[model samples]
Target: MAGSCAPWVGSAYLFLQSTCKAIALPSLYENSQKKPSVFRALKLALADSTGSVNGVDMLKVHCSHPHLIVQLKFCKQENCRHFLRSYREGALREALQNHLQLSLAITAVPLEMELKAGNEHLDSMLKDEDRCLEYIYREKPDRLRDEEITELEERLKGLMIHQSTSNSIPVNDCTSLDSPSLPCPSQGSSLSPQVTFIFQGQQFANRTLTPDDHQKFAKLVSKKWKQVGRSLQKSCRALRDPVIDSLALEYDREGLYEQAYQLLRKFIESEGTKATIARLVAALEENGLISLAEELLGLHSNEDCS
Candidate 1:
């Protein structure tokens, strides 16, 4: 009876242990299955529906059907992490290549040729008289280089000369030319304020100026530039307006060295503009900023350090 009882007890314990093991294993599997796919960890490969994952011996994604299931058991047994990584990289490269090929096929264009075609279209649009002014206005500043500006100025000057010659007449009406009572600007006399304003307006419309007007503009621009620059410099703080600083730098680098130098000098000498003071240091490059701008940046850094 003791022996029979012993055997029964051992069998009961073994059955219970087996049942527990089975239950625990399923829970572990469930947890693993619940794990979200890590985009960085998983590998990808391309294979036809009929293709076998034979010899790859890695994360064998047998594309037998549309529902591509990974053979988890095979991957685990093979210790295929390295292989899978390489496979994924290769797959990615191939995918990129295929994409580029498809894009090219759809467009049927080489990049250089495409750019040339676009430039041709832009030229065609610019040729239309009604559209030319709009096109010029819409052009990006960077695209309007010094050469383009110079060319436009020359063209405007030519237009102004042509208009003046065509409109000039010897006699009578106020609307027609040559009314001695209707005073026009001459070398001997100072223009009235209204006449000066009108001339300025005409220059703006034409986007061209006479030599005297150009000199006056250059002086005015230089003065204003210096005023702004000095104010920024005296702030003892960082610059706030990156756009202004960027413009200043561009002007300096692109043949306006004198303007750049003067502006930087003024910024140092004058009390800084409150609006622009805080932004100076971070946006302006350390090496690129003038001595005064550098000093201002130093003040900011010191404040930050404190």
Candidate 2:
């Protein structure tokens, strides 16, 4: 009976050991695969968190220094404190000199409470000084203090005096053509009539037109038309008669008579009344499109009669 029991016990132990090995193998494999990936990610995060300020890795310094300081501050373990102190003091000093500048690196641990509060009063006073400086240099006259106003006024007076002196050209000096006695080209040329067009509130004349003037003017008109069209389209509505009329006028100014006529015709078809037709006719006649204007007028008269 003892021999039989011993053999049975040995077999049971062998079975248990095999089952434990089967269970433990996968977990060990998984841990081996997972641990390296976790370590790599942690390494990447640490690398990214480190910021270079004055060519120093601030995050690494911040992390490592705190750990060392905490060990020194607490000093619970005698061996730990001694090792940390010795390492910090000099063990890697020569190697770390290039990476950490003495003036910029944290040499001592700061009290947590003091660091939290900072120098609030000093910061407040500096902010106040900045505000005062901004007030003195303020562009808005209404915001200026009395002293600032007086200083600015004196500066302006000095500027005006300097300008007056510099601008005073002698009449006898032939080289100084900016004198009052010297006639300006525009004033001199005003004796003769000049062909001029006013487009977008700016005056353009034949004399001022360069060789590429027509192309430049056409490009400008195209740009303006595109801008106006975009604005009208964005409003999600049909273009108004006045906008069409303005565009027609711009096209006419650019010598795009066909485009101008087409725009006017579309305006007339959509929004023209008797008064609008009259205005259109006057505009067309003024722009030397008499035949077109007469045709419009005739159409209007026929409509009115009908």
Candidate 3:
């Protein structure tokens, strides 16, 4: 009877232990079902700690099929926490709908360490447009839509046109030969003073300055000045600091120094300052064309003396 009682007692003790474990252990399936709510709480806790959260750090979006695929990274516990709250609050879905015009589908999938590494590599490559383009062409040529391709092509065309226009040298306008003839005036006369200058390698004889002639000259100078100003502005805007140096070197290489000289002369005449001349000289020197820069400066000095 003692032996039979001992066996029964042992069996009862085992059953009680099993029942306790069943009540104490959490169910993984149930936790998964409540993931959105759990994540939301986690996110709020993280937000409270970090003081701020960025949406980009929480989610990554891509187009895999007709549907948009959103990848959530939880490498950082704070990011994961914030993302959970955002997901629960439906902010993530709303953002996707607004930006990509796509509907959301929530699905739970196993996360792999390798997948996270691959995503990081892809993000780095995308920072460089050429590399990103090459990657797309090699790995996912069909990823981009026809409309997206067309839009990109149009943008490239517009950029090329803008660059060409900005770098182009303005051609001298010789449309009108209807310059008014005015009598040459004495040097001390307040009415009009004689003026002579070389333009496009053509030397204009000394002629009396009248209001009409002054107006015409002023218009011509103002137009050319504006062209130069625009070119400089564009170069600065595009962050092309070496543009002037390149232009000067190209002109010298092509034996078009006379044209370059004439352009500089017009700039000086219009601006009427030594600073413009100094800038031209400095540009040529920076491009390893010190001789050309010196010659240009010499001509400016000779003109001053004359």
lDDT of model 3, residue 146? 40
For model 2, state the Cα shift of residue 226 in Å. 14
Candidate 1 lDDT, 68-125, residue by residue in tens: 2222221121222222332323422232222222222222211110001112232234
Q: Candidate 1 — which residues are off by over 4 angstroms?
A: 1-254, 272-280, 283-306
TM-score of 2: 0.14
lDDT of each: 0.26, 0.25, 0.28
Q: What are the per-model C-alpha RMSD values against the true structure?
A: 33.9, 36.6, 30.3
C-alpha root-mean-square deviation, candidate 2: 36.6
> How many Å off is the CA of 77 in candidate 2?
99
State TM-scores per candidate: 0.14, 0.14, 0.17
Q: Tell me how candidate 2 scores on lDDT.
A: 0.25
**At residue 4, what lDDT does model 3 achieve?**
35
- Top candidate on TM-score is 3
TM-score for model 1?
A: 0.14
